[model samples]
Target: MSEEKGLLHGVWETVKTVVYALLIAGAFRTFLFQPFWIPSGSMKDTLLIGDFLFVNKMAYGYSYASCPSIRIPAVGIDISAEDFCGVFKGSDSRLFGSEPERGDVVVFRHPTRGDDFIKRMIGLPGDRIQMIDGVLQINGEAVIIEEDGFFIETYEQQGPLGNTPMCMNGSVGIGGDCMKERMYETLPNGVRHAILNARDDNPRPFTDNSGVYVVPEGEYFLMGDNRDNSGDSRVPATQRGVGFVPLEDIVGRADRIMFSSAGRSMFAFWTWRSDRFFKAIE
Candidate 1:
């Protein structure tokens, strides 16, 4: 009987350790760094599908983890904490006091369903943002674009073509269809980042039909670097795209890409793309 009791105690201790470890990990993920996966091509050529990234939770401030909350052991969930933290403690602006600036890559909850979304800030409160003739302009000033560098393209032929010879700019060396246009964009606050534009087609009509929207206070306008393809604030509010993200809806800021994979199938370790790993999100 004593032996059975000892064995039971050992099992309990092991379970306790596992629970404690999980709690610690959850706390760390909630407060410090959280991992997210890119499931869409909206930010393509910048962040690809199957890319795993780390978001810096501290970039803004604590939301709920820092406050007191009721924790259930077996359930592994926080019951309630917002009210205990303070009326507006976990609300929005905390003492840390950092506001989302233009050009800063941010992750916020979708206004429609509260799902997390990652995008770059383009327009701030009171800023007039309009896309004219395919070029992004802020307050009637055209955004500047500068060339950064170029890349190489590799190809393989199948069937009767067999293995085709790789070509460069003309027919065999660096500068053919591989040349990509890179530009530097400076935000209203002077924050600058490199942006890529690969589309050669003329700019489509501005999808934003709100008629010269003046961003209201406590809200922001966001757009993906793949401007031509992204569904952002520029779209009408009636649509499913992000119309405007409120200050409180922001979850955190994307700090860096931890790991990335090119093709689908998460289980295929051999298919992981190593080149994109640890790449900073510009």
Candidate 2:
């Protein structure tokens, strides 16, 4: 009987250990930090393809965690891994009571697709946003454009030498390559960033050129840092130009780039772009 009791106690102890480990992991994943990858060039120059980033889940606040009280059983549903990693729920409170600000690089659910998209906040709620002659304007005030040096190409195509279509001299293409002079613009409230210009007479394709858009109270207007190349709020909603992202759909603000890898083949871990490791997101 003594031996049996001891064996039962040992089993209980092992179960407790496993339970404790799982609880700790759940807590960590719930409120500490999370990882995300840059899947598109929308934030190019700041974040590139294959870039792995770490987002501070607690930076805003705790939503899914049992802070004020223990979470009720069965109340928390097992959504997909993405929703499980996120802190908030429903289309409310955005995240942790925090709100997005202009110039913040944020990750939010696509208004149309429900997939994740990362972009810079260019217009806040109730702000008048429009593009005038390829320049961003807010509330009748022009965003200052300061020229940075010419953007230089950093990588080359790997295909056959002549396979890539060559553009006529000074022809701008869909890919935001073909760099020209750039300028840094400081918004009225000190939100300053860079904007690019191709130095050609051709204008952007958007026809709504001048209009006063009062960003709805719960929605935000986002734009890509690569202005000339990005398909963002500048494009009308009908064409799916990221019209207005609801605050509740935001996941978290992008904090920093963890690592970046290059090349079409990612099988080799060493092929990562080592220089961009641990780079802070502006």
Candidate 3:
């Protein structure tokens, strides 16, 4: 049975190779970078629903929760990590890397929720933020806003037919366009970005005017590019909106779009967003 012994040895070697490769890949994803997918329109006009990007984990230093050094079982071989670490502080600060700057797009763990979220950093520690009649004011000064045109997108099969947020002004995208209000907002830090005004000047009391919030140290205030539709710092996390984000929760900054596909599966080549691929997230 010498021939049978040889075949078994060859198979064992192949399995070992695959396991080693996966271990290396897992370490890279946990320590250096991680792929992230945009699943909602919260950061619309900048980050689309089908957009894929990389979150630079190294930019914010290592945190237990950011990328827990864990293992994945491969081919019956338990590549178990002996040590796993993360932070679960009621409030905490960064461990090593630089702090998140204003206007930077960020990904973080939801303070009181189960999933991770991506949003724009609008207010830092000790900054006063408010929205008055659809205008954003920071530290008692109104941020600049310039009206642009409209942001239109085709409704996917999952989108509702009418009387919904996506189907704004029913038959808008199909007949003509899903006319969403567009504006270029300039942050206090001189960072300018596009924001969507889906509500068409209709101000919701809860979000449109949030009666001045003075951001506390070790926390941040975030918002979405889709101003009217996003559930951001303006709404409490208890209500499914991201509340004051603790600094320790931030995972990384999203710098560019890796690739995107309109189809439900990543393998759908026909639905690729070629134009947005490799595009820098501004």
Ranking of candidates on TM-score, top first? 3, 1, 2
Q: TM-scores, in order shown?
A: 0.74, 0.71, 0.86
Q: How accurate locally is residue 149 in candidate 1, as Cα lDDT from 0 to 100?
A: 65
Q: What is the C-alpha RMSD of each candidate to the true structure, in Å?
A: 8.0, 7.2, 4.5
Question: How much is 231 displaced in model 3, in angstroms?
Answer: 0.9
Query: Model 1, which residues run further than 4 Å from truth?
Result: 64-92, 147-182, 196-204, 207-211
Q: Kindly report which residue pairs in candidate 3 clash with one another.
A: 64-86, 172-177
Worst 10 residues of 1 by lDDT: 158-167
Across 65-167, the per-residue lDDT of candidate 2 in tens digits comes to 2121222346883344334534444435534567667888877666565456778888888998987776778988888877788654433332212112122
For candidate 2, the TM-score is: 0.71
In model 3, the runs with Cα more than 4 Å from the true position are 68-93, 158-176, 201-203
lDDT of 2: 0.64
- Give the Cα-based TM-score of candidate 3 against the true structure: 0.86
Alpha-carbon deviation at 128 in model 1, angstroms: 1.3
